[model samples]
Target: MRLTHSCIITNEVKKLSEFYEKVLQIKAETSGDEYAEFPTDCGILSIFSFSLQESLAKGSSLPGSNRNLILEFNVANVDDEYMRLEKLGVEFVKPLTTQPWGNRSFYFQDPDGNMLNFYTKVK
Candidate 1:
């Protein structure tokens, strides 16, 4: 079996799609007005609709606003991407640093505080 797409339940689908498109230079595919997708060479990044009020009413949402997942993007240059995204107003949770395993990496947060990483091999 193959993984087609992974979804992040978000209240602001349009905002997220816009952010990803601008920051990552990705094209989002539209599935009606509720869903947006980023078509990857392999799979796709799908943003699904979520209602905080409904989740709270159903006792599904936690007390806090943050989700419990992080998404990673393996890029060609973590440092370059980090700088470019910083200029685009994407907030970084951690600055890019070289790993002991010889990879350079950094972490950032999405509009909904979903952790994201950009990493590249260190030469």
Candidate 2:
């Protein structure tokens, strides 16, 4: 099956959604108070409140949370993207560097502690 969206659950959907908008320049739509979504070319990046998800799922505990998940955004130039994003006060884990996998990448953290990587394949 094809994936249409990726979700992030947080206490502050507005704050988290604004992060993507102000930082990555994503346009997000808020559905009432609980949900907001960014319609990216890859898929929709969404955020929702824990209380809302709980109400729908009938008591599902939150995940422990790990760094294993990364939201990778493809860019034409990794270093250029890094400079632009860093100027906006983004915290980066790694600067522009070519990985063994043949991709130049820059890693950073989102407001919700989500790891994000902007990269480009090196030919």
Candidate 3:
């Protein structure tokens, strides 16, 4: 089986969509105010409206309640991406640091407090 995409259920679709666009540096293809998608070479990252999701799968999920999952992005340069996000006023949960496994990365939070990591494999 292959992974296609991951969706974030959010109460503020537009707000979160805008935030992702700024962070990813790509425009989201939106479906009304209910859904938005940022397509990438790896897969599509999507945002779904809470109301719509509730209607489809009632009481299955909660908005802004993510604590254990960290959405990760593979970048060309962790340092460059860190500086760019820093200037955009993105709040960092952890500073850029090299992992013992040979990955250089940084952690930050989305508007809904969802943790996100951007990393580059170091040789």
TM-score of each: 0.83, 0.90, 0.98
Tens-digit lDDT string for candidate 3 (1-123): 888898999999999999999999999999899999999888999999999998999999899999999989999989999999999999899999999999999999999889999999999
Model 3 bad stretches (over 4 Å): none
Prediction 3 global C-alpha lDDT: 0.95
* Residues 69-92 of candidate 2: C-alpha lDDT, one tens digit per residue: 999989887888888888889988
User: Which one wins by TM-score: 2 or 3?
Assistant: 3
Better of 1 and 2 by lDDT: 2
Off by over 4 Å in 1: 51-67
Poorest stretch of ten by lDDT in candidate 1:
55-64
Name the best candidate (by lDDT): 3
Better of 2 and 3 by lDDT: 3
Ten-residue region with minimum lDDT total, candidate 2: 58-67
**Model 1, residue 40: C-alpha shift (Å):** 1.3
Evaluated at residue 86, the lDDT of candidate 1 is: 81
Scored by TM-score, the top model is 3
- Candidate 1's residue-wise lDDT over 29-105, tens digit each? 88776788998777788776676435545655432266567767778777788889888887778888988998799
What's the best-to-worst order under TM-score? 3, 2, 1
Candidate 3 weakest ten by summed lDDT: 1-10
